[model samples]
Target: MTTRTPAAAVAALTLGLLLSSCALLDGSTGGDPTDAPSAQASERQRPTPPFVRQGRMSIEGGNDVTFELTVTGLEHDGEYLMLEVTHNYLEDLPGSVTGRNPPVRLVDPVSGEVLRFLHDPQSGDEPYGTHFVPGDPAMPTHEGLPTTLRRYFPAPTQDVDYLTLTGAGIGLVPGIPLTRVDAFTPAPEPNAHEYIDPETFAQEPELPDEIWYPDNPPPPGLDTADRRQTMESFVDGPTASTTRAGDQETIALHADEMFAFDDSEPTADAAQTIRAGAQTLRSHIGPRVEEITIVGHTDGVGSDTHNQTLSQERAEAARALLERELDGEFTLTIEGRGSAEPLATEGGPDDEQARARNRRVEFTYQVSPGADGSADTDGLASARRHVAEPAHFFDELEPVTTLIHDDVDLHVYPMVRDGAYAFQMVGLQNSTLSPLEADLDVDASAVPGGPAQYTQGTLGGFRVQEPDTGLIRYVVRIRTGDGEYEDFADRINELATGEQYLALAVFPAPAPDVTEMTLYAGAFGQVDVPVR
Candidate 1:
């Protein structure tokens, strides 16, 4: 039940973009439960379909598309019905097809109860074949090729044999056909099928349940950013607590919390405390925060020269620690106030407790009014300041594949990152005055056939196979733009006129022994892109 989608579909989904929804298919409720699709009575009680040569059924689909439904395997061992389905799409996509939900469901023709996949999509427990397992299909060879996926439903008794496939924006065809089926070998038992608990499978666990209350800040194996959970500094500290001042938040860290007597270096205990303070700071400041001002102070007991030096060093130390702990996207400014400002007290400079309290560090952060990087960005404004270079610089990139489609020219540059294939989609030009719309999607599945449904397939998609071994180099992410990671994993619906954008698609790095690979791009066809 891994939410299978067309390789092109994930861009909209993974990026959280809301597109138009397709209308749901309607089905009637009353029908005989025991009737079989075939006239033979003996075949009704059989565990699988009788072997029929060329056993494939084609349905004329909406949007000028033809759906070829063929069964590769089927079996019902009491508890659950296991079925394999492959749908081959023929003809071109209709103009009306935009970013829309193509949700599909398995329906009981007789009972009218909508059935779900055996495993939950959110469970992250996908069958091995789910992503192009030899027989399992999530791979596509061409737009017109059949891609397969497996499905599970309440087992149909001897009386029940036929099922229905329903989808949004598509009409339901009763008594859908299944292809070549024989008695299942080593039939599976009811207990063998995985059952989903609604409560447990409702959503993916953000953190492992076993380490919900880890003894340390970060549970082992968690990402670095998640490790911030380990920060205990902000939780319980008299010297440091989050206090809101006007519109800004302040992490008020008392001197005693960070440093020991007469020391500019962070104390052994203060190291952990500072780490906690840094994590707390991130929660308050956020990644969008641009500036962090760290100011340090000292008591009146030290000479003005010594206090100034100590305050400067302490402020610098605190700034370094915070920068390392935070997202490191801010401009940090460290300053030394020395003994200029002490805690207000009746004894003033003479009070011993006040003197100790005077030595402290304060952190403040600020953000620009236009930090969201929307369509209109000042960064873009600044980019306009530089002289525009000629377009030929891209041609200098060696071994590029240039192809023209719908009057637009596309340049593909294959590169490597961390030993993985990271190809660039560059030089996308409209080459027309009236304006044009083009799909710039990429493939995510490694299989030759698409997922059971057509959603996971990519029309103009590509994959890499080791030339010597023919092993697939699966894709992981697709980003658009030239700036190192400017559009990392971003899905821009369509490229319009005058829109000059580049994309970078990443795959698992091939081994050093892999010197060459066969790059397969759906319509663009296969090409040999060298491995570095």
Candidate 2:
């Protein structure tokens, strides 16, 4: 699975933060205007910060199903203070010949209401390819916790404050299903240290050493013991409904329970005998049975490719026997898990027991008994309401102001000195008007560290820390705030921060009316620092 951008990474991290009983993460925002130490400094002291509230929900079913929710950005919207959240889920399969499709839905933690919203699963278009063949042992497999998905709403420019997510469809690979969805209030436009000129894609950074692309890798490690094996079901049955490739409605299957079979093989005869045993168990499968998965495994004794082939053959032989024994109109999908999992220590002294365990095949059942308790509507509802807001501290500060009109994407530039610094930005809304990108405007000024020119770019949001003794002399731009450019600069400058208080107030553009305030931020964009 492709690792999502850093912002989405934060969403996953947010869940970890919530699961831990940690105190809130805090940061200061605005700077003190006066340079001198005045007597009224006591009066200007900041107010106390609110305690960040957090909650969570975990649901499991046949073929491991888990979902988690984290609340991040919280702001008042009319009568209700809305919460920006990040949602994550995992689905692991145990047995079944067919891939399972788990449905996803969002529910209100308090009211138990299934929230609604426009879902765009195909928003980001990035084609990925690999050289490994389908059954290659070296190929990355999803046998243990395979399904990984992550989505980030950089800066929500729409009216989608409250969100509820549920598992809708998942394949029957006994792999972890991991997905993350997040929400946060917008800050000033982020200070970008790097720049990729649109004209030539020439990349430069106001801060050189701080910004560099990383060699992105898939986020899984299967080369270890203690690896869990998951199975996905595949059956060649006709679709219940007529639809395109991804539109067919077929029965979703998963192993209700699981047990491992392993033992070193004295030879090929032993392996065949164990497979025969598993086939005998197939006699238990009935018409209501949707599928059965016989995933084969090896002890990594040979080359990865060779071991994968051997594992696949073992799986096929077992599958063929079960299919012939079951004799049904149901579909069958077969594949190999290669040598991703081990049932025992490969080099243990009790080699006979180890070989027996490693060479043996166990059975798991996937029965479709109409709509039983597994489909308990109440259980599903209770599970959905288990959503909660996670704790966070908005530290490290940079602010930007943007002015948008009918046309022209007014951009912003960040100020910096010699070396390197990094930052992000988010847009904060001030009214009820729908957030429109066309109406957004941005800008930057008051750069520190001379003989030093700065470059500008657009990103999600910036970070802010409490202005303490040494933190001083900095500037930011309102990266992305859409609306008629009405007193935009004044509204941005009004942002305040101190020891305890962090206020995000917006001055309405001198206009006919003001409705709501929304915010946004850039995820990875950074800034520059002075070297000399």
Query: Using TM-score as the measure, which candidate wins?
Result: 1
| Candidate 1, 1-532: lDDT as tens digits | 3222334221221100111122111122222212335435423433332211111111112122333444446555545555554544444433223333223344333222334344323324332123322222222112354444445444433234454433322223234333323433332222111221222222232322111100001112322221011100011124453322112444546677778777878877666766665544444455556788888988787699999999999999888877776657678899998888764232533366556556778776642321211222221111111111001101123335766666565654544322112322333445666445545334332232221111122322445666654444433321112311111222222334443333333343444444566766544456677543
Task: Name the regions of candidate 1 deviating beyond 4 angstroms.
Answer: 1-237, 346-350, 367-532
Off by over 4 Å in 2: 1-21, 24-294, 301-313, 324-326, 333-532
User: Please, what is the whole-model Cα lDDT of each candidate in the order they appear?
Assistant: 0.39, 0.25
lDDT of 2: 0.25
Task: Give the clash count for each candidate.
Answer: 18, 126
Q: Please give the distance, in angstroms, between residue 127's alpha carbon in candidate 1 and its true position after superposition.
A: 74
